[model samples]
Target chain A: MSDKDTTYQVPIGPIHPALKEPFMINFRLDGETIVDAEAHPGMNHRGIEFMGMHRNPLKVIPLSERICGICSIVHQHMFTTAVEHAAGIEPTNRARYIRTIMAELERIHSHVLWAGVAAHEIGFDTHLHFTWKVREKVMDLLEYIAGNRVNYSMWTIGGVRRDITEKMYPKVNETLDYYESLYKKLEEIFLGDPSIRLRTKDIGILTEEEALRLCGVGPTVRASGVKKDVRIDQPYAAYGDLDLDYVIPSRYGYENTGDVFSKTLVRLKELVQSIDLIRQCVDQMPEGDIDSEPKKAVLLNKLKKADGEGIGRIEAPRGEAFHYARLKEGQEELDCWKIRASTYNNLTTYAPMFMGEQIADIPIIAACIDPCIGCMDRAEIVEINSGERYSYTHEELHVLSVEKTKKILEGSL
Target chain B: MNTIDLPMSLDELESYFKEGLGDSISDLRKEEIKKGLNNRPVKLIWFTVSRGSFRKSIELISDIQIPHLSVTSGSDLGDVVELIYHFAVNYGYPGDEVSVNIKVHLPKDDLTIPTITDLVPGAITTEREKQEFLGIKVENIPDSRRLWLDEGFPEDRYPWRWDETGMENMSRYVHDKEEAANPPTEDTPREGGGKDE
Candidate 1:
């Protein structure tokens, strides 16, 4: 690794075999070691937040779900909660419980998806296949319960648009049992296997201090030994009533190795917790009206005065998602609405993590944050060589990334 | 937690801005604010004013020191370009949700306002996106980088621009498509579209 040796620059991209979405990372490599790294985002800017203002308030529900497909329910929940706050309506206890069940279901599906992705990233093809196979059950259950697998538009302004009937309870219970059993098997595979440990342990180590400074959220922050779960800090929905512990890695079986393994363990354990929470919601379900009766249609026809400002904070699967809205006196739509995804705050740490790490470790290290790649797809990267600066298109980078990743996987296998 | 009660009704909140803040607020009505549909509270207040007063209004309202700037949303309203700056203050506490709305209207001709990045640092990235998308000039903002703007996109082109018909005509062309398709050979021209052969 001497200075005279020819150094190579490796670009992992907006689309690669390892990632489902778009994001680009450039690694300045000295041999196998990554000496420097830079992350460029903005590749998938849909301008959905801007669209929120122009569209009708009711129409925004479907639009909000499009914010992030994997975490669609959370997006809908956040938007609906903000609308509820704006409208000054408090949902009933049963409605809160139903919302919590949906939220937990989403968390389970999201974590399982990440686990599968993590497996694929590390060249664990069998594990990847197995995890996704089990994940299909959860997705199927989601579709059965919410009428759709990805974006469950169940949440409405005042309460859930639909109710979980008694007939649905048995199916819910069966699904929970199946997921829990599958989780046990997956847990053994992820934690008990030596290869899994070797690939992840001590690699992509994000220390507690780095986690705090970088404002990392979700499992990434939890794995680093920070006990800042939004469920505990600001409990919305039925989470306020549940006697559940925020499953941090430090509390459980694993010592804080500050590595990808720790993050994996935290996410896996949270999957179990999500299942248990859903079970509790279903068992103690109260019989009540699911939807609020619509007020007089005449009241809705009038031009509602927009007044006051409010902030809506929800813990999306990635981490804390925030929305701010202000209403003007006579405008039909919101005067102001601002959204900050957890990834926006957490992505800043990519540079530090990538630096001083091996190029092979980049995928897992980067994916450890579970970044919202779609959010950052709009950015373009230009490389400066000698005096000339050449721009790299996202498509070019994506193709190169997939080729390199496939090569790496074949070599590792 | 106990239910929080605020001193002002939705109309009072609107009046506070109209008389106290001296700005025009829109979308405020007693019926909208009072209606509790599905047990969810509906709070409403609207304000509209000249676009020139946006920065000042933001500065004045944000003086209360709300820790979080939740989001900033911009929309095209045919004749006038509307920008909304949402601020959250002490809403969690009982009797404290007196949220303020300061609306600023920018005529089609002049669509620029002073950037509030100095006051709220978190607004840096979102403000840049809005500026480029809506063709709004945010003066005094720290970072001027073209966030979503890249090669093949015109400097003045806006992605979210809606004309009187509310259609976005901004096109994102592929400037490097040719270069990508026919990569530079050893003898191609390097400076321009192709490397010297």
Candidate 2:
């Protein structure tokens, strides 16, 4: 067969084989190696922006929170911040601190969940079970604070709907302590485990230049030693008063390799940093009304009469995400609304990371970004010359990944 | 409030664009919102550049620092499509980041903006999204295929637009539009009460 005939197209999802988020990555493979990769997202686009533009500003809060199940707080924070910015309304100082704590708590939960998913992707079920079991403490805290584990509608336009009152401080501290206690063990399993090191080290490497050119966000880019965290770079809410630094891989004597290992390193370290940040917020949280304009009628009237543009940017657990909100005078609805999630920017970096990697590495590399992508489904492989097709279910993909791990353990890979 | 350890301040950026783009730049404004106990300022610079000077303004910004393009937000504003390029500069320097939002008004008749993928490779996603949603052609985009909308979604009907070519015909707003056409005078009450009616 000619060299051209050897190329095969492997489409691994707009039907995700990983999590429930639907995203498709089409791979042009030469033999078992991925020659090129492209991301096809939007299978799950509910047109949230369209819905947001149609509704009044206040009604859009719940809609924004539903944007991503994993990062609901991220969306709600951006939406409220954007609306508040446009309307020129300052959230109470206490509200800012509460927002910071909630955001940091969400970050911890998200990163811990991501750790479990990453472990599962590499066929480490025990690690997955352990990480997930450990993640419950934060989830419980979140539920206690916001009354909902997933879509915590704690945010309002001017301020927040909920407060991190003294009643909830003990639960928050206990959760933080639980994670802090488990941090070292979690670190050892994901970072120190030799098998995981084999699968992740120098695998799916994205250089700093590629990261910068592609505008990759979150730990995905920070792994490459990029200082682009929104929290540190542009302080919003209580981040301005708080002290924090970038969580790049090099900070702990590791090279900024921009590999899957570096990415893991960044996330695991951030878990500790998140714990520190939440504690700072709890200690320094001020005394004031959680809601700036508690009267809904007054807030709604102000919003309807406000005419301006605002942008809300946040450093989500995954990366830097922002929302654009425009309010017009005498308009009951938003003049314009745009929500840019972190995965949207990180999607571009997939091309560079997937290039020249083996098919077995797809799951780990794909999950490395902690993608808030589309739902999981089966993958189909097409052979060009034969015009033949084969399908791989999620179970089959998991098997392939597990088998790869076995091979690596046996030193056959 | 936007204290920076870097050489470039928010004011310097304002002057830099003025010097580089000259008359093409208009509606220049610098805003800093203070927050938190420290009262730290979140700095932002908003300005408009003629479509002819759009790429030039970005290049001038690039001369000082490698500007990070944080997606573009586009809207269908009556006779023109407004595209705002939100770029963040001085990221490595902590607490010094400035959101330089550059606006360009593309007339509805000629809805085209040159692709900045060459300058900002990551902009391809947002640019492609703008093309499919607003029906504004991104001039010379490397990959111009639709990003968000389905293949079966009508090509002529832009969802963001509220005009004849927009999706208003099939939208719920279509019914509301007819009702809105009639005036609500002193005899009739508005949709929401004037003072809790």
Candidate 3:
């Protein structure tokens, strides 16, 4: 084909390595720059919202946790808060603190995990390894406190299931101190390192206007200088009492450039914010009954009689995790259930961010949002008339991206 | 003394709607839903508008500085599907989020509503979802292609519906205890549950 006739379309997923979860991005490229892009995500669709409506109110907490593995505790917290609202159940002060502790710890681990993934996307293997090595401490603490590493079944309708006893205080404090020490190391390596700065500084710029118009949440919008955090705006659990500061890029001495670098800074600082929140929860935890009634029988009995709807919106490490539950009077099951996971709202920002960016920058720019495709992966690429199927593995896409980067550098693109 | 009894922002949001929408609103109720130990109450303001005022209701809510459209959920009420559009009012105002949901009931025969994608681009995915799962046709949606389901999947069969054709395999979960107590003979194995023994 002639150079004028060679406009190409690239299919980059359904299954990919640059992302931790499954989703597809088909881009229409004009030479070296992306002209337009379409995201197809459903490969990981488990119909959790649909399924949540079918199950008993109490049983859906664990199911909701599976919506995003990385944000499991956040999901549980959202679901429980909604159910607690509908049922008119108030968790004790201690339970609120415990829930906050668990959610913030999850945020720390999740943000650290995202940092490693972002580092890997930029071809920094040592940085990825180092970031993940620091993540293990938080993971171990999660295991020690909640008794599970990934999906900590810590939340219930009225309160938390497990209490953070006095004995666990030492380990929790130690983990917080451990994460505190790594903050400088993380910033020095990810932000101070010249290569990372070169790759991420002005790449994939998303302005505050675009962030607001697209309804970006969590770190994605925070990095773009929107001081909107669900925890700060609509405090749930112990967030109101924590007196926390919003962790945006501007606060860390960087003008919000709304780029991959800003995104990295937002997440890294959130790691620090989460650690402080957890320590505060530990220190301020009061002695009280964890739940109005700890038994599932009493909880379910109470919920079955609830006759109202409640909205639970929390700031997951990624962004705002929202859950809406309607419980009709005298019904054991939910009338309607909807989950707007943070990643779902953030997904809309991708097409805008992808515009005018180089192929090589796609991985990190797309990863900059910290997308959790596990919550949203219904993807397919098909020809309209012929019904022909097209797909690309993560390796093939990565190679294509890297090749384009090299071409641009050689002035041959 | 329940902690959930605190004053809610839903009252403020309701008054905003009452002043803005006026006669367009059919029903509005603000309820204090959840209470936190530190006096942060989670509040919900639910209102229903006629299908004619659905678009106006959404526009008014957006005008009230609540541009964040969280999610839209629907439930099958036999002949009608009640669609609830949830928005976070007073967003970015710390500890003052009032969830204002504008609900509209669309009949099964006419399952269409004007798309909010133009007003809020973030709503495209959720609108696409309702189109696929709830079988609610979003009129003027930018992309009408199936969002979650494959092209080859049955177009008439919606996953969230409670009709005879929908969720056939999942009938056990949908059916009430009385119906579930006696398993449908068609679902049960024939002749002592033997496989060509």
lDDT of each: 0.64, 0.88, 0.77
For A29-97, candidate 3 gives per-residue lDDT tens digits of 666677778888786566677677778988898898887778888888888877777666777888888
TM-score of each: 0.70, 0.94, 0.89
> Which numbered prediction scores highest in lDDT against the true structure?
2
TM-score per model for chain B alone?
0.64, 0.83, 0.78
Candidates 1 and 2: which is better by lDDT? 2
lDDT of 2 by residue, A40-91 (tens): 9887667889888999999999999898888899999999999999999999
lDDT of 2 by residue, B1-197 (tens): 13433647888888778988989999999999998999888999999999999999878766665568888999989999999999998888788889999999999999989989998899999999999888899889999888877665656778899887777544533334444344355797556735643
Q: Which stretches of candidate 3 lie over 4 Å from their true place?
A: A1-4, A374-392, A399-413, B1-12, B169-197
**Distance from true location, Cα of A23 in model 3, Å:** 1.2
DockQ (C-alpha) of model 3?
0.49
Model 1 agreement with the true structure over B108-178: per-residue lDDT tens digits = 78877888766665566667777876888878778777666554455555645556222232221134444
Better of 2 and 3 by DockQ: 2
Q: For each of the candidates, give the backbone clash count.
A: 70, 11, 9
Docking quality tier of model 1: incorrect
- Candidate 3, Cα interface RMSD: 1.7
Q: Which ten residues in a row have the lowest lDDT in candidate 3 chain A?
A: A374-383
lDDT of 3 by residue, B1-197 (tens): 12222223566667767776778787788775344556766666889888887887778766665278878877777899888888876676677777778889999889999999888888898899888988888999999888676554556667778775365544433324333334346666434534544
